[model samples]
Target: MFMRAGLTIGEFSQITHLSVKMLRRYHEVGLLEPDRVDESTGYRYYSTAQVPNAQVIHRFRELDMPVREIKAILATPEPEARSALISEHLRRLERQLDTTRAAVTSLRRLLGPASPPLQVELRTSAAQSTAAVQAMVDQEEILRWYDGAMTELDAALADACLSQSGPPGGLYDNALFTHERGSATVYVPVTATAPAIGRVRPFVVPAAELAVTVHHGPHDDIDVTYGALGTYVAEHALAVAGPVRETYLVGPPDTADESAWRTEIGWPVFRTGIRVSG
Candidate 1:
C-alpha cells in the first residue's frame, strides 16, 4: 500500500480546526485548494504548510467577509494591497455593526413605555425664494438621493455665487411615505433670483402653518418621533394640506455623531384651530 505524500483531508481538517464540509467548500470555491488529489480514488489531501492560510481564511470568514472579497484578499500578493482589502471589509463591517446597534437601541425604546412629552410648536413659514431639485425617489434610496441632491445644490450655489438664507430643507410628498415612491424636493433658500442650471432651479416653496417637533439623535428611531407628532396632530385635528417638511438643523457635513443630530419634523396644519398653544 502506498502512503500519501501529505496529510489526508481528515488530518488536515483536524490540524486546521475546520469542518470537513467547510474544507470541501473552500476547495470548491478555489479559496484553499488541496495540495494534491488522487485521480484513481478521487481523494483530496492538503499539505501541512497550508495550515496558516486555512487559519487566515477561517478568521476572515468569522468576520463575515464575503467569499469573493476573501478571494481578492488572498489573490493580492502585496502586503499593502492585502491590508487595504482587509481594511475596506473591516470598515464595511463596522458600518453594519453601527446600524445594528442603532436598531437595537431604537427597538428597545419603541417597545417600552410611551416616550416623554414632545413640545410641538405651531409656526407659520413665510413663502421663500429658493433653488431646488426635485426627483422621484424610493424610500430606501431617500438618504442617498438627499446627499447627492444637496451636493448638487451646493455646487450650483457656489457657481452662481449665492449665499444660503437658511439651513437646507426638504419637502417629502405623501406618495413617498404612502406608496414608497414619490417626488422629493431638496432646496436652499437664496436671497435673490437665482439662475436655473441643470437640476437646480429657482422656485417658490409655498408658505404653511406647521406643527413641529424636534427629533434628537439618529434617524433610526425618528419614526417614533414622527408617530408622536402625528398622534398630537390627529388628536388636535391640526393636520392639514401639505407634504411633510423637514428642517435639517444639525446633520451630516455638520456632525458625524448621530447622537448630536437634530431634525425638525413639521406637519402641515390649519392656522385657525385653537386647541394647543405652542
Candidate 2:
C-alpha cells in the first residue's frame, strides 16, 4: 500500500505541471517537503496524495501571486481564507488592468495620422465665476498630492454651497511637467470664487475668448481632446499662447461617476490665417 501511494519526484512533477527544480525549491522553502529521501543514494520521493496540493500551488503562482502569499494560503484550513486571499489579489489585478487599458487607449489616439494643425487663433475667455482652490504644490509631488488636494477642494466647495462646472484643472508650471516640483493651482471656476482657505486661496478665473470644446471622458484621454482642440485652432488659423484651462462641469462633487464627467478645454490662440490643421 505504501509503495502504491508513492510516486517519484519526476512523476509528481509531470502530473502537477511543475518542474523538478521547482519541487526541490518548494521543499527547501518548507512549502512541500518530500514524503521520503533515500538514505544511501539521496533520491527524493513524493506521495501521489500530494498531487492536488501541488497543482493548486502551481495555479496560484501562475496568476502572479507572491510565494509568501501562496504559502499563507496553503497553510489555511478554511476555504474562506483561501478565497479571501484570491479576492484581494484579484482586486489588485483589476486596478492594474484599468490603468493599462487607459494607457493603451491614450496612445492609440495620439493621432499622427492626418496630422495636427499648424497654429491656433486667439480668443477671449470671459471673466468666469468659479469656486477655486490655489496651492503652491511641489512639482515632483503634484500627482502624488492631487487626490488629497482634490478632496480638500471638494470639502471647501461643499461648505460654500457651490457646484463645479467641470472636472478640476491644474495650472502646472513648465517645471512640474518636466523637472523638479513646482507650484500649481487645482481649480474649479464657479459663478463666484468661494471664500478663501488659509494660503489655499481663491480667485475668479477672468474669462477670455476661449477656443472651447467638450471633452467627454477621463483625463486619460485628455491628449485626444487636446488634439481635437489643436486641430480646431489650426483649422481656424489660431496660435495658443496661454495656460491650458479645464473647467469641470460634472464630476466627483456632483457624483463620483466617470461617464457623467464633462470638461471644457480652452487654449488661447492667435492666427496668421496661413494655418494647417494637422
Candidate 3:
C-alpha cells in the first residue's frame, strides 16, 4: 500500500523527461530511489513529492556530474555547501571548455587549405650540466608528468641557489613517437652542481648538432611541425642518432595562454653528409 504515490514508473518518466533505464541506473547506484516497490508484482512507483529531487538530479547529470559527486552534493544539508560543490564542477567544466576551444582552433589551422613552409635550422648545442627528472612515461600522461617534474626541479634549483643558464628543455626518446611509450627527461640548465635529491638529479645533456625548427602556438598540432622538420632533415640528408629535444622558449611559468607558447623541436644530426654509424 502506497500513500501519496500516484505516479507509476512510466508516468514519472514522462513527468521528469528521464528515461526509465536511467532512473533504474540511478536507483542501482543509490543516487535516486522510488517511493515504493511492490514486493508481489515487482512494480516501482514514485511520489509527487520526489519529482523536484529527480529533476535536480537530471540537471546535475546534464552538467556531467558523476553519480558519487551528485550524491554528495544532494546529501549536503547546507545550501552553501551544495552550491560550492556545484561551483567547483563548473570551474572544471570551464577549464575543459578552454582546452576544447584551443584544440578546435589548432585543428582548423592544421586542416586549412594552405600549408605553410617550415623553417629549419642547423645549430650545435654545447654540453651542459643540469638538474633533471627522468621517467618512463606513457604518451597520454606526459603533460602531467612534465609539470610535476618541472616543479620539483625548480624547487631544487632554488634550494641550491642555482641560477638558470638557459631555457627549460626536454629529451623524448624515439620510442615515444614510434611506440607511444618511452623515457622522457626534463631539465633546467643550472650554473653549478645541483643537489641530487628525490627525482631531481645531476645530468649532463650531451652536446649535439640538431636540425631545429620552431613550432609556434599550442602543442595540439605539434606533430605536424615535427613531420615537416623530419622531412626536411631527411631531404637534406642530415639524419643522425639521438633522442629528440624540445626547448620551451615561451611556455608555462611564463604564460598560461597556449596561443602564446613557442617550442623549438630539435633532431640530432651530424655536420657532414656522411652518415656516421650509431
TM-score of 3: 0.77
The whole-model C-alpha lDDT of candidate 1 against the native structure comes to: 0.88
lDDT of 2 by residue, 145-226 (tens): 7767677777787788877665567555445544665556677655555767643456656655566666766766766777
Tens-digit lDDT string for candidate 3 (224-250): 788788887887788887899999999
What digit string (tens of lDDT, one per residue) describes model 1 on residues 1-278? 99757888899989988898999998998999999998998789889789999999999999999899999998999999999999989977876776787678788888999877888888898898999999999986787788898999999999999998988899999899899999999989998876788899998899899998999988878877888999988888878868999988998779999789999998999876575644
Residue 262 in candidate 2, Cα distance off native in Å: 4.1
User: lDDT of all the models against the reference?
Assistant: 0.88, 0.70, 0.87
Against the true structure, candidate 1 reaches a TM-score of 0.77
Best by lDDT: 1
TM-score of 2: 0.57
Q: Which stretches of candidate 3 lie over 4 Å from their true place?
A: 25-33, 39-41, 48-60, 63-103, 256-258, 274-278
Identify the superior model by lDDT, candidate 1 or candidate 2.
1
